[model samples]
Target: MSIFEYAPAPESRDIVDIKPSYGLFVNGEWTDGKGEAFKTINPATEETLAEVACATDADVDAAVAAARAAYDKVWGPMPGRERAKYLYRIARIIQERGRELAVLESLDNGKPIRESRDVDIPLVAAHFFYYAGWADKLGYAGLGPNPRPLGVAGQVIPWNFPLLMLAWKIAPALACGNTVVLKPAETTPLTALLFAEICRQADLPPGVVNILTGAGETGAALVNHPDVNKVAFTGSTEVGRRIAESVAGTRKKLTLELGGKAANIVFDDAAIDQAVEGVVNGIFFNQGHVCCAGSRLLLQESVAEDFLARLRRRMGTLRVGDPLDKNTDVGAINSAEQLERIRALSEIGEAEGGERYTAPCELPERGFWFAPTIFTGVSQSHRIAREEIFGPVLSVLTFRTPEEAVAKANNTPYGLSAGVWTEKGSRILWMADRLRAGVVWANTFNKFDPTSPFGGYKESGYGREGGRHGLEAYLDV
Candidate 1:
């Protein structure tokens, strides 16, 4: 749960050790890059945490070459059981150093300390443990008698959930025996660098997992590189389109997990308080940085009033402030650019005829923060209802029947995820079948497990990221 009620107890940042500047991790070694660097700030206080190196095109070439060498000689030829040993070691190391990773994640990514501690870091370790069990058992995974690695994988992840996204992309690739050349988002590169340290702690072979830090140009170089065999990206739909075009005629196995404007349908029969909590957590989690966030609330006309009243009350109870505070339900926005995007979209939400109701909260003066916001009297055609806001904003629309609810929910081009709240099991099943999303959660929101496959269709991008399906992206079937 993103929203919490507790006394103020801050997680100490002293556990983390950040260098003044960081370099690229190629061949399990560090390179200072071409001396071009950018500062990654603590979004809570707008304090410059450290200077991160910007990887050049040649840096991408070196990383890819190292990954290829590892795949060709060391990592690929290693026995599956031996690879499993490394994964298990990495997972254990993550659990041991969980506090340090959690603190650095909150400092770098602007999520609350409790969330970074409880939710993301645990999930990151879980992904590794789950995939480790599948390492030596690929033959029985229902793919084929034998499935081979895809060689060098070029992975680019967004800044929303840094360590968790790394786990989602890297763990599966390594389990399937594919070496990776990963490029973490520029805004949040610290955890990925630390993860490179974890690989060293596990005694993972040189060049088996290389991390190159930079912005979009570095990502483009990796995506369009000649020797890279697979491309996996989790970011905006526009960038996903560009990656798809660049690899259109190439042999690179591509997978993209992009944006979403998910709909949360709440019927009159759904428990009001329960549905209220679900709705609030749906959009406000991770400052709405999630790609499958339930931003659109489709309510039954008969219960829309009561549901909305409870939702407003729930929103009022939320505490918004510093990322390090235990009491702050919503933390700082991820970055200044993301803050501007949220503000611009919220303004458009007001202009497009949606009645706005912002939760009362005293935001911190130094950092980027957006209070919990709701829009009632919203039309399906409004820009607020149709677009992905990626902030702490909710758009509510009323519908007469299940058919109308499904119709409104399925109207978006994104088919990443959706939510349904109803007491009737048959109705839940019916709605789940027609929601047109990759994941449909009933009675719960923002719940994830490593065993379940997660991805989207159409503009949300294709190919799954967890379970057995995730293995396909890094393997040759």
Candidate 2:
């Protein structure tokens, strides 16, 4: 039996039990927005999760005012040890309510429950724990002498990894004593709402970490708010470009963990079986809904055919179904629009004379879903090779030499991350140095660490998140 067949369906009302119709959390209170209310939907089921209040410009002003006020009067003046305690409490609460948070994450964001439970939630807690340790250790970091907090931070995160992204934004900002007003993606707001409650439970000061749920307008409002001292965003290259332009002359510190077209290089010396597994994890994890997904596969021409066969077989075994199922590997696409994007790109690949193949997997009727897809005979010039599809699709291209592999890998404008699968330590180090990406994984892909700084280069965006480096985003050095 498949994993979905044995796994029980999630109750529809579980999110309601946690929280419903979440509003703007400002000044230590949950208040309704001045604008219209927008309904958030479960990407897995196409069902309404809650009617989240949309934050208008006025709402952004209110949030910033509250945050600034708190920064001066409360959060900024609070001792680092006290900040650490609150972060520790929030981390512990997240660990205790992990299962609930996991289910909500999968239901709303269309990520597999296994990833939510084992990967996202755990990392979310660890991010807090790691930053908590750094709360009072700012002097130890090489940020000159006495780096001060940058007042209020405005953060906008993508729909891909809702709570984890929230944690990535909030943890460091709070650790550095910067009040924050964050805008969670409109599609997945439940986890952020739940996070707001966790902050409340941790007794985090009001206006310290406010969550506003809405679409583009709300995010723009937050970014343009005069009092916002720093702007951090995680999303598409297009949006990242706009943000780069928006914050061009401003003194606001900026960090963008944007989109990627990371190359997963499989060398002739690599363990074929292990390389296949690494490739599967690289692109297919989270339904390929990741900024740093290894969407491009650079196989050594010597082992290309064998590696392709092995990878195809491995993909055939992936059970793509309900994300809540423990046994499922790939889950539903985040939304119908995203599914359309994948389909359109696949069609273009076919039209461009590339061979498109999809794994034989049963899909749910209600939600937007796509099978694991791959395009062979893909050249560097093809749209599939160049663009960020942001779906369960891979573009296979072969390279003869290590130099050729590195050239192909860095061909794209994005430099968020890359993967190197090789047995030789020297070759791995050599490739890692050549790859322009900020994060390079040897025999692995998509690994995160709170102590590790993560970001991109060139068009992929600027600055870094995570580790002691993340504090720089919220500090006036």
Candidate 3:
């Protein structure tokens, strides 16, 4: 007898029109870069998606100069209300072009189409709209009466949630009257390039938004550019440190959203079913590529075995396959490099004596893939519990009491985000206060809103993004 399956319900790849080779978006124009070109491929099938121009020193300089010119002559002189009109146009355009963007994002980033469609794209549009509303209201935002835009912002975004991360950095920067030169991760440069077209379609002023497609070197040049008055980055913590160091003596303002090993704690008093779902979503969503993914699961000792049993049952039902598959709950790991990292760390977890449990799912023949994984019998001292495994991997550690939970959770260097599950409001409040994380969710996990400020504390990096707080990053308060 055959079992039930979601079938091959793939979102049509033909919905997006990817060009043969893409150029850098500099000064509001598609221009060829001086550096060598590299091909970006589909991680699921290892098929060449497009050849992208890498930004050279000259390219970075040109983009920065363009942004500086726009800042000095066009963007800065514009009234806040007028600037808002442009932002509103861009936001509306994003909504109008949502389908094309979503398809392209799933292809390039290897996220499930549903996530790209429902979660990522909507949030992208929402961010632009949210910041657009703030464009003319900077004074009343409580950031002071005369907050001025920073000159030229050099933004570097990561591959995970490519368009969403771009939105997080770009929307607020533009709304604050700053011009920007953005460097997208080489593996996921397509969406950023397409967004450049959206900017042009919106009739945004020339040089106001420039996109450079390249790898780490490209990002380095943009970050180190003398003309860039502000630098904002989202990626690994080690890389964030280098960026911070590069801007240390310079007058350039800097903000970074880096790595995390967030702890998701479940109390015995919590609803087991709700906590299990939240825990699953926390580590398995986006193939667990989230910077703030709840990678560490801190379960109360009493319910540890019971919760694991339920969690294992739920994991069995996950559909992992092609990213374009509408029914796919787990997608391909973003890249071969990322896949290797996840593999190495999982091996380390096993070597450290943690029992590994992986969901039974067949991966595609070609492309980077990893089964949904969790390590049981994990201790706070184990590498799996302490380290940031930015993949669909979870490390389970049990705690006897609330204090013990907090103690084990806070043992890590990362302080990006955490989650708690309990029925008691007072206990929720109590756990939240002592978590030492920047964002703490009561019952849910991985919830994001454009109007809410999100950031990290300690080694997870400094400063916030989203809401009125985000405006401060791009402004001269």
Q: Please give, for residues 196-281, the per-residue lDDT of candidate 1 as tens digits.
A: 99999899999999999998999999999999999999999999999999999999999999999999999989988998889888
Query: TM-scores of the models, in the given order?
Result: 0.98, 0.97, 0.99
Note each model's CA RMSD in angstroms: 1.9, 1.8, 1.1
Please identify model 1 stretches exceeding 4 Å from their true place. Answer: 1-7
Which 10 successive residues of model 2 have the least lDDT summed?
A: 1-10
Report the lDDT tens digits of candidate 3 across residue range 79-124.
8889989888988998998888998998988899999999999999
> In candidate 3, which residue ranges exceed 4 Å CA deviation?
1-3
Ten consecutive residues with minimal summed lDDT in candidate 1?
A: 1-10
Root mean square deviation (Cα) for candidate 1: 1.9
Q: List the residue pairs that clash in candidate 2.
A: 28-206
- Give lDDT tens digits, candidate 2, residues 1-477: 233345565434354374557788888898999889988778778988778899888888888999999999999999999999999999999999898899888888888888998999999999999999988988788996798899999999999999999999999999999999999999998889888888898888788988888899999889978789899999998998898889889888888888899999999999999889888999999999998999999999999999898888888789888887777889889988989999999999999989988998778888898999999999999999999999999999999999999999999999989999998999999999999999999988888988899988987888888988888888888
Candidate 2, position 2, lDDT: 38
Q: How far is candidate 2 from the true structure (C-alpha RMSD, Å)?
A: 1.8
Which has the higher TM-score value, candidate number 1 or candidate number 2? 1
